[model samples]
Target: MLTAERDELMRIIRQLSYEQREVTLASGRKSDFYFDGKQTTLHPRGALLVGKAFYAALRQFPAPVQGVGGLTLGADPIATATALVSALEGQPLPAFIIRKEPKGHGTGQWLEGRKNVPPGSRVVIVEDVVTTGGSSMKAIERAREEGLEVLGVITLVDRQEGGAEFFAANDMPFVAIFTKAEVVG
Candidate 1:
């Protein structure tokens, strides 16, 4: 059965509208579809639903995550919202942001927000959407390099297109609030 939180999540996602047409994805591929996850993920109600759903999803894991974060731009709001709601719920999961490239000057850090987690600290990576899984995987790599024990990945939308399978083949647990068909159809 869908919980109240999940139902709310669906309601918010279903309310999003989009135009159908060929467009290039971040992965640089042409397709007859496109999704602006930010439209839903950044909306007031959408943010609340995403935050609550993310928290609930994390509960299914074996260990508590020390933090939740992801690549910049796309993943920023989702991470922040999750962190905020987690705190309100008293669980207080911290959030972090991963830069696409290291800053050129002053500290030259790649990951921002909070300090580097202690080695083996469990962390969950968030993404607004997963197409080829490149950005999410890159975040995972950076997290691992920073000594984080990546628990898995959570995304607002999964484009299908082998993203889930790719993560699974590599032993990364992947979960999403909605799939391409769920949103597009």
Candidate 2:
């Protein structure tokens, strides 16, 4: 369900992230319209709205989610904001980050914040946007490798591309706050 917060986030996203022009996406797909979710995810009010929406999603999840995380860079702010919101909501969920590559030094783990969450703890993967679903899939795989059980995937926006199909084929529960049509059309 899109609540008031979710609706406001959509408005902000449309105003900040939506663009029309020929451009290539991270998935290497060319499109006339693009959504750079970071523009909104990184904004002050945008982050707050995203946090509330994600936290609400977590609370409504069928199973308990011990942590929230996704591929770094894009997912970092989303996961962090959600965790902060959860804390404000009094549940205080821990947020983790899944690095694209292991850190260059130290433990060199591909995942972070695991120390705060126990092994085998259930977690939900969050993403700024979904196109081919590759990024979200990578995050889920990494989380599992780190001994975290993935409960589902949540994205700030879905391009209405093959992402949804990919997640469905892989049987990964997926949710998007807004679709391409909603933002672009």
Candidate 3:
């Protein structure tokens, strides 16, 4: 039987996926299909469902995770809601942000909100969508450079455009809540 949360998640995704004539992708490729993860992830119901789904998905990890985070912009809300609700649920996983570029002033750090994390903290990188795996891979690189152990990657949508294969080829465990076919078809 589907849990209440899982059922809600399916409803949110179905509601978010809509037909469009032309859509622009982050990779600058033109296509007749598009997925605006923000349309769901940013909504009240969507945020809760996504956070619960991610928490459930990552709970299978072999190691204890210090936190969850992802690249800026796309990953911002996902990480935020996950961290917040996870705490309320008493798991209390902190969230971090990986900047696309180092801040020009002040701390000038590339990764933020992880000051208390010691070296080699186990972390799971989160993403709203994984198309070619480029952005998620960059986030993984940045997390590694910060001395964090990457546990895996959790994406809301897998565009199935070679992203899952890319992660598997690199020996990285990648999980997604929805596939491109589920969204587009």
Candidate 4:
């Protein structure tokens, strides 16, 4: 269900984050257009839209979605937004963060918020943008290592590159709200 807020968020994301320039991406590829989802997902309006949209997307998952999260930095804000929105919706989905590496001190955990997201819980991984799907895959690996079942993956923007194919090949359900074409056109 695309609410009015979701539509407006898409428009704002294009206005704020979509850029056209020759630049190397995290995937080590040059692209004509880039989507900096953090710019939009971090905004108040954008955050609300992302939460609402991602929450809705989670409902379509084949299995129950107990929580949501992804790799740190990019997925951090997104997971928070979705969890907040889920709370507003009265379901209250917990948000978890996957560290790139285990913390060096203390418990040296690779995942934070484990108190809420127990093992065996089903979770959905999120990303601000997907290029080669490397980051999201890493998050999935971390989550599985923690004994979490990844229900699916949802991204804000899909570069329309190899991400979809990668997820498909891995047999993981994937969804993206917008594509580079939709944002740049």
Q: Pick by TM-score: which candidate is best?
A: 4
- TM-scores of all models? 0.91, 0.94, 0.91, 0.95
In what order do the candidates fall by TM-score, top score first? 4, 2, 3, 1
lDDT of 1 by residue, 67-117 (tens): 899999888888888898899999888889989999999989888875635
Q: What is the lDDT for 38 in model 1?
A: 80
Show model 4 residue runs off by greater than 4 Å.
none
- Report the CA-based lDDT of candidate 3 relative to the real structure: 0.84
Deviation in Å, model 3, residue 104 alpha carbon: 1.6
The digit string of per-residue lDDT tens for model 3 on 123-170 reads 999998888898999999999999999989999889888899999999
Worst-scoring 10-residue span by lDDT in model 1: 10-19
Q: Is candidate 2 or candidate 4 better by TM-score?
A: 4
In the range 78-124, model 2's lDDT, one tens digit per residue, is: 99999998898789889999999999999888888878777889999
Which runs of model 2 end up more than 4 angstroms from their true locations?
none
**Which structure is stronger by lDDT: 2 or 3?**
2
What ranking emerges by lDDT with the best candidate at the front?
4, 2, 3, 1
Worst 10 residues of 2 by lDDT: 1-10
- Note the residue pairs that clash in candidate 4: none
RMSD to native, candidate 1: 2.0
Task: Point out the higher-scoring one by TM-score: 3 or 4.
Answer: 4
Candidate 2 to truth, TM: 0.94
lDDT of 4 by residue, 1-185 (tens): 46677679889898888888888988788888778888998888899898888988897797578989999989999999999988998999999999999999998999999999999999999999999999899999999999999988999999889999999999999999888777775
